[model samples]
Target: MFPIIFVSLGPGEAELITLKGLKALQNADCIFCPETPARDGRLLSRAADIMLQLDIPADHIYRFSLPMSKQRMDALNAYDQVYAAALSLHHAGKRVAIVAEGDTGFYSSIHYIYEKLQAGGTPVEQIAGIPAFIAAGARGGLHIASQEERLTVIPGITTADEIEQLIQSRSTVVIMKLSQCTDEVHRCIRLHPEYDYHYFENVGTPQEKYICDTRQIEALHFPYFSLIIIRHNSF
Candidate 1:
């Protein structure tokens, strides 16, 4: 099997791609750029965008359309298919690079492929990129965690009771995958008005923004997937 590498292109901005990640992409025999089907049926890849910003050639980049469904088996099967295809490329003596967005170890689809590669005994490496949450924290000048306080990252699918319980700990909570649980988030904010709330959208990109007001967040639906950070004012 051919050796493979996972390159992280941080969040939305092209310049966020790390120096190491860029070099890996430059040296790769070919690249698989992960993309998702947009609402308009167009395949969009943030990795390709970042590569362009870094002056990487688009000629060898192939579209990897990862199925973005909540159905567990569907996505898992898709990952397996990609894994098989990657192995085929490796067999032809190609050193492949799969460009990933965001950090490798944090909720990345690359996790599936990485594990499969491990099982198959292929030489693989990961280039870490800044996670969206971390980038958002830096952009908004918000301290993520300090002293004895803890930081929790949860998906929006979390139950309301679970969310309320988490807030009671007075720790910072970062909410993602918010398309499903926006109402619960608003309710949580209303229930615990003491905590600071900031809504971040398209973090690390030119279109990035944050809202300090709960009312504004409730009134608007972000065009892209967004993150909501709730933290106690202790710091």
Candidate 2:
């Protein structure tokens, strides 16, 4: 049976890749990576450096763009293309590896590919890796959650109103994808002057940057691979 291995690239650190993820990539017959054309740039490119260290051939690495606009038909069609590519490769007796950041199971495109493959009765395998939350916590010296604290994780793209509401109610909130919604997130942080907030970007990358200030950070440059932790006090 051909194995479709979903490999997590980790939070922009080569050492963060699991031993299993590295082994699979070394033996992979075909590799698939996701692409995003945000004005800032692509997060997967950081993973590409790992692939380079392994000296994988350029042709062996293929990237498919994830639809970004509000075109559902085109988006679904793109997903179908990903499904078709993997399916075709699996049928050819090749072990396929799909790469994602953090872990494949957490907000990874591999989930979409996996569902489609399962529907077609394909054998699949998953290799987990470190998540961004862990790395963010480590970088900022913040503990993620305690037994008594309810962890509320919100995507950074949430509307200003929704973010304001969450910050008002939740004592501990972790926000992901802060690079895109910096201004809104900045505003939300200001509403609570007494709390401690940490804004970390590129959590484990060489270019990682962070700030632990309640004051609104204006035009604070942040990488797309980021997480924000807001905690009121000890839980």
* TM of each candidate vs. truth: 0.92, 0.84
Best by TM-score: 1
Q: How much does each candidate deviate from the true structure in C-alpha RMSD? A: 1.9, 3.0
Could you give candidate 1's per-residue lDDT for residues 62-110 as a string of tens digits?
A: 7777778777787787777778888888888898888778887787867
- Global lDDT of each candidate: 0.80, 0.75
lDDT of 1 at 55: 79
Candidate 2 residue lDDT tens string, 176-197: 7767677776666566556677
Which stretches of model 2 miss by more than 4 angstroms? 38-44, 70-75, 157-171, 216-223
Name the Cα RMSD for model 2.
3.0
Residue 210 in model 1: shift from native, Å? Answer: 0.8
- Model 2 clash count equals 0
Residue 105 miss distance in model 1 (angstroms): 1.5
